[model samples]
Target: MRLTSSLLGIFLALAALSNLRQASAEVGDDEGVSFFIPSGHDTATNEDVYDLLRCARALRDEGTKSDGASKAVASAIAAAVATLPPIQLAHTDHTLHQVPERARAYLPAAIDLLARIRSFAIAPPCLDRPGIPTTTAGPYKYLIAANLVNCEAIMPYWILEVLRLGLLLSGNSMVLAGFSQNVANAQGSASADGYLPHISVYESGSKDNTVPWLLVAEQLWGAAGMRTFVVVNGSLTRQMVTDPFSGKYHKQHRIQFLASVRNAALEPLYGAPPGTYDNVVFVNDVFFCAADLFRLTHLKADIACGLDFEVWVGHKKGHMSGITQRNFDQRRRRRRLQSSSGASNAADASTADLTLHTSINQMSDVHLDELVRQMAAEGRIRNAPVKIKYNFYDTWVSRDISGKQFVSDVPYISDRRTRDILSKGMPVPVKCCWNGAVIINAAPLVNGLRFRSGISEKGECDSSECSLLCQDYRRVGATRVVVDPSVRVAYVPWSKSFHGSLSVGVGPRVPWSQVQRSGALQELEAIWNDTKRDMATDCIPLGTRSEEADLEKVRSVDLRLVNYTQMFLEDRRQPSQQPTVPRLCNLLMGPYGVVDYGTAFDDLRFAALGKNTITALTYTANSTVNSLQFTYGSGSGNVTATVHGRPFGNHSSVVFQPGEHITHGVVYYDSDGVIKLVLTTNKQRNTTIGGRTFSTNMLESGKIHQAVATPCPNDLAYAGRFRLIAIAGTSDIRIRSISFLWTKIGGKV
Candidate 1:
């Protein structure tokens, strides 16, 4: 419900008069959601405040007849205040309706509950605010209700949220359950620990010792049971194009370069056989622990991101080369709390890189167990209706399902329709999001849903390359995207508690199992509506080389808009349900050289995958092509082993010169499982292949490999031809399934 004036007045008035606030720190207040009830308001006495709070609690608990949450909260407040007519005589316009005759009997029980709530807090909300409830004396389950909004009113609202957590004990059963805990020693997010996750960390031109630290993390993570891939100083800006005629080099567009780097980070997964890793996590330069990755990996969204926070880490003193360090002082830390709720365009993230990355490492320490324990204990998270000290960071890459930027920085996103659901501090649904970090289901990316820059010159939205990735996810029927507020991150490593709460909530909005979804085609159609829609709930142009390009009205999205429009408006029926077009595979089987071996072509991603080149070759032949072992780059380095046909043929290797790459070749095999091989290079040089082979030629399945073509990539070459890049086929002795892998070659005039 829209906040009423009186309710707002109550919030303002109570905040001014509240005695719970401490001098240096805040406790029970969530953003503006205050838990300390005002004992006195305007002229109300100390006794009067308690009585009103008690009455309201009773009314709420009694479930007094009301329409919904907003109405119910209003009714409870009205009923409570109605008792003291002299105090709130001018207020409580909140509910015109009176308390129902059926509900006013449980006032005594509420009074008792109020006494219990005050038992732990020694003083006020800020300093003496409540801490995690412990059951050291015996079994105790506290009645945990949290402020899910930012209204510090006399009639403060509360939601039955778990601080989104319950503490999990390691070996013993003495568990002190809660969400936001400064008292207990945190361990892990119960379910996320133990499983060894292959971690991929990306680092670039940061003015800090990030590379050396990541190298340290590589070893530490392995000790902590994790397979880590650390890319240090692997900046994408060096990917240059040398003009053939001018002999001069050209740099790629910022957006194009960024997309290439992100893809490079996922190179291992993309080239690996299907299902190499369960989840591919991408983390930015933020102060985070292993617990953070474990917790984020456990998130439920197909594309899940953590809520990021900022603390003034540093400043740019000079031109990146010479810089003086900023003192880690209280003043700097306090600046974190000064950020207002506002929108940040992609420009913010671009400029954010200027700040010196925090020197100390944040990735090595916390294990999965520690993070698990922390989330389980903290029954809540930041960014809800609570006062999150750090304003929500990383807004540049996030867009709600309505395709608009997140309107609020904390207390959950203030999107009207999705607010209530998000307020519970769960994994909230969104169209796209990439806060400081993200965990994506590797399957879709493995299939070939890649990040790409926009063709602003061609009337397409020059939005963050990330935006198109989400669209690609939707296009390929992998459309479960969301941002999990439960996983919190900060830029500075000053205060662990100040980093914000960690809890996935007791019950996730989306569970842990996979569910079949036919993508959000309808929602996408609405979001990408180029005409007849409010600009607010539409895609915003970002990543431009010039201000003028950003201002241009986007006429289309994909350069191959015709193909996209075809896919977008393709008969809305599922692959099984559609009756019109024949199965794409049926048409692709022979001409496309689709080898039907054991579990061949089972991975749906292969239908729209990239290419691969032949690496190592080992074939045994008597009458036909027998045993095979071609060590091609399949992301996971799956070496082809002799399964059925094996005579241990003499192995031979093909070594290409520096910059030399395979272009296209023919593999002619017969029914008796025989073959002859012919491989050609991009320089018109064909290696000796013994003979022209026996029979059938597996024609180019080029259409399948080059599905999402980029017609106007910024890094275009005036003259270039396709050469080998990656290959697809079984790692076993399936000689029939060797497909191609191609990428662009040297440029021309």
Candidate 2:
């Protein structure tokens, strides 16, 4: 009789009455058969037991088409049936007694077999034939690989959305590997629309009850044509401890563990035969969408990456929520307190404030003005709202002594200029990009490119694995390593408080009709429009030049010497045993000045000069002096002289012995109007001025003299002249010849 309603009922009743001892004896008599009732038979309903028996009978009745494969299938089916509860107590309700653990023990193998059958039945014809191009049918097939650790909460929400988006954008040609850690039972299922994502879960050293959830995932995904693989590694003998304060368990060797798991997820693609897939998209724990994936793929580079963005914690409004009213209020209060307390913390405060402001500006938030006003109550900012003046994270690689090397993050201003040069919708070359969400061409992998786990040959740390891999790819002639700015993505930070909310306050949101009418949305739209217009109009060409070209251009030229002259003052002999007064002449020259004068001889045959005697020579016109030259009198012995309050020439005091003589001095004016004095003497001598001794050298030998004095401030353009002062310290000084030359002396030019 067919195992239908009435026949199944009679069979179940007869089996329930039969003794377990008798059934065991009867199965023992059959040499190749072993049958024993499960322990929890009393808990199972009659129908459940009958169904298990019917499945086994059907498998046994089917003739062995292929001896090897059919025997394996029959053994698997028999094993599954043997684990079911006994039919004797099947009619009893399962509420009072623990049901048998047959389903969990046997369902994996059974489901795997069923999945393989379904794959064989529905898979594309190209899948069975080696050397056939799968891309010929549609878009290039992609393998999205990721490693998950206890991500059950996010599986149905964020992760599922990622899978859905990937499939939608790339068609059914996409495959996903959701490798789980200590979450084998976490429930997830494939879509009912016949799109199955491959799920491989490993449970290690975890006591959490994840099996039920994982089974649900298997059922759902399996029905949707997905192949799911699960492994429960309960062999870990280490004691699991939870922190008393945070109530979270510490994960030992987190980095190594994660790396191993990620490697495991990549194993399938790594071992796949050639031409299996065109790309392998390695997605980390970040939020992204289909458009981001599509944009990254469009670049078609060896490695195309997306920009990493951040979101504020506890802010669930939108992408603009990072800089909310609350942030503005807090910043304003802090600034006000700092101002009242006379604290020099403006710089620190502004840095913190700018971070939020820039995020708001980038997101095109509508409330930027209101936020700015709230923060800048004292009109701290005069013009536009604050923005990130430079890029703090994104960077570029440039050629260094060691070939292409990673440099500091590129400044935002510089990146903006680069963007303008390349224009929008272009992938900019980079040495390496964040591996969080990148589409990598399979060719690199085929050529043996792999991520580094330890120090690389270039001495880079494990963290630089992406950079090193890209470098290797370049070495192999795959130089297209780029970042597509158009493929923008928001980072979803791990948060203990985050539930399964569709909106995690990051990236663009779905534009529901109701959402479109909101004031914030309207403001955001307006801001975006204004930003686009401003960007279009304000963008300027970078006009970059090479170092050689820059060196080839002339910066400035020195002023040429235009005039030179010398003068001698009239000799004055003392009359009536009295000292004669020295006369000074004002020099008259255009932009250049040159003059020379000699000391006068007194009538007594000795020149009488008081200490600190001053003489001035005024110019005919007021003009900026670029440079000046002066020569001290060689006849003046051990005298201290100054021009415009600075030591004349190099020495603070022009010291000379009875036989020694003074030499020429010079004063130079820089373009900024600062003056410096340099001097040379006829002989080397030790002289002390301002408590410092210096050895003077003769100018005739081209030796330098030391100058000790404060810089004298003289606006030659306004003052119209300079001074010459001579300090005679306890000696009769005879002045000799003096000369002066000036060049490029004119109004501020």
Candidate 3:
């Protein structure tokens, strides 16, 4: 019997369908079936074919169990499968030849099947039930999501590591949603990088072959009792279109597009009820170890992020440097510059032109202006140069003037400090951190906080997205956001050779490799081990009492007399050749003023000794003068006082017998911008100041009196300088010793 070509085709398809059905029946629900794709074929490609067969078997089983709509949907899947080449003939080489024609027909049929399934609103029986928690024996359940773009070479390794750490080692339930775009072939020979294998054969006029690997990931994750979701948006390569507004062709490559894809992956979390998962881990292009994942989830902060270090690729460090480090470097450079030259400290200096740039390189002009304005308000230069200084002695005493300490904003210092703090199992407060490897509390999402991609009110672009999200978290009253330095991660470059270079290897050329193996890696391992051991220990309190106690103890020690003598010695040695003075004396005369021992010469000039002034140190308004003790003797006339260029007549006046010691106490702005002066003497005396009667008490009992004159401009709310005028009304007055304790009352010093 002679059969028509069409009849022959139908007969072949029917026979293949029968065999497929029999194979499906032999395989149980829990068992997965493998496919024959020839040895030496790409392992990834073979895995892809195996995944397709599994999907076909699942659809075939669904067809057998249902009626009407379900049956029709299953039949559509079968029809799509039948049109494709037979599984045994689906070798990489054969698929390469047949993909053009077969994919054209198979793709539409597959889409039709998917469309019908969607219309029926029925999920395949193999999938977990929605809103129903699957019983897992793991310690914690996590939903991990990542966005990929042409990352086939690394995806396999990354996914495997995540599963190994999240499920196997840590015993945690994991659900992954991998999103990709423009990661497939666009009609070219596959590159020799082993990234997208068999790409030339599978290029069905589509730029994305991401489906294959995603399918393999889903299968592997599913076999381990976890769920996986893949969202592919095809190629985002340069597809030019005429702009509606400009009427000119422009490529559509905006961050908004990528942000939209990310938001889509987050859709499941949005639809799910509150508390659907314990945490949502969003991973970017990073090569992380198992401990990193465990540490991130264990942190349990509102948003816990990890530190992403630079991976040396081709002998050059990649762009994964820590954000804290970058900011710290900028701050350090600025500080050095400010201490060097007066020109660099000018208020008009441009902060935007600072040497060290942050991750967000191009700050908006308005933001830059605001930064400059803030620096000016604080009397700081944007970017100043540092002048190198030399000292002979090393006896400088560190003083805590205002009882308040601040963290250095330098990246190296801050990063080291943060690492040290976290190494001790303490969480430190941070302004912001990169979200490269972060485990976010789902409550923030459930309450409507999302990753923003628009310009903020401060004109900050999307580059500041992480910072903006942190601000939003703070606004919503979420818990603190911190970076766990113990959770170390590295960035993965496209070149496998670069990754290999940094791995275990012995060579002088690759010093980092040797360092990594000998020192860095071991230290990291130690930290990881320590973190795991201390996981159950409570974190050190946010603000410990020990620090405050230390401050109080330091304040109690009276270093005034010692600091005064040092200042006097330094003054005497300044004019001598090869003069020797204690380093402590030089430090006291440096940035923070301790004391300026006055001379008895015709023009006795004492330079200002404070952070703010050249003659008399300046303090913010509402400051407290704890105590003031000094010994002096006047031969004849009264001593006058001037503060910030304003005079206080006879308020600092004193009367002394030729050898009598006198002490005076003065508080600026004591009552509504009025100065209070207290005089103590061995003998009681009456003095007149601005025609007001002022009396002195015994040397033991201090007398307090208001100054007859104001020392600052009436309109000025803040005082800037203070000066002591020792005018011998008749003869010279000698100052023996001076000491005082003061601190800015409530403002930052």
Tell me, by lDDT, which candidate is best: 1
Give the C-alpha miss distance for residue 735 in model 2, angstroms: 99
Identify the leading candidate in terms of TM-score. 1
TM-score of each: 0.41, 0.32, 0.33
Worst 10 residues of 2 by lDDT: 562-571
Q: Which regions of candidate 3 fall more than 4 Å away from where they truly are?
A: 1-141, 165-209, 234-243, 249-253, 313-419, 422-428, 456-462, 493-749
lDDT string for model 2 (1-749, tens) is 01133543465444433432333233223221111111111121233223323332333223133454343332333222211111111221121011123212222233222221111110101100111111111356566665444433223223333434343333322121111111222112221122223444433433332333334433433323334444333212122223222334443222223433444455455567887667767765455544345446544566778555443312221121122121223344334323322232222111222221232122111122122222232121112133111111232222111123322233222333233312332345554565357777777665444443322232222232344455455445555556544454443321111111212122222122222243433433343233221211011111132211122221221111110000001111100111121233222111111111111111110112112221212111012221121223323533222222112222322433443322223332211121223333335432222222223333223232222211121223423222222211100011111122211112110
Whole-model lDDT per candidate = 0.36, 0.30, 0.30
Model 3 CA lDDT for position 556: 24
Cα RMSD (angstroms) for every candidate in the order listed: 22.0, 33.9, 29.9
Candidate 3 collision pairs: 184-209, 328-410, 328-411, 329-411, 337-384, 337-385, 338-384, 608-614, 608-615, 644-721
Tens-place lDDT digits, model 3, residues 51-117: 3435433433333343432324322222222221111111112222223332232222232222211
Total backbone collisions for each predicted model: 54, 27, 10
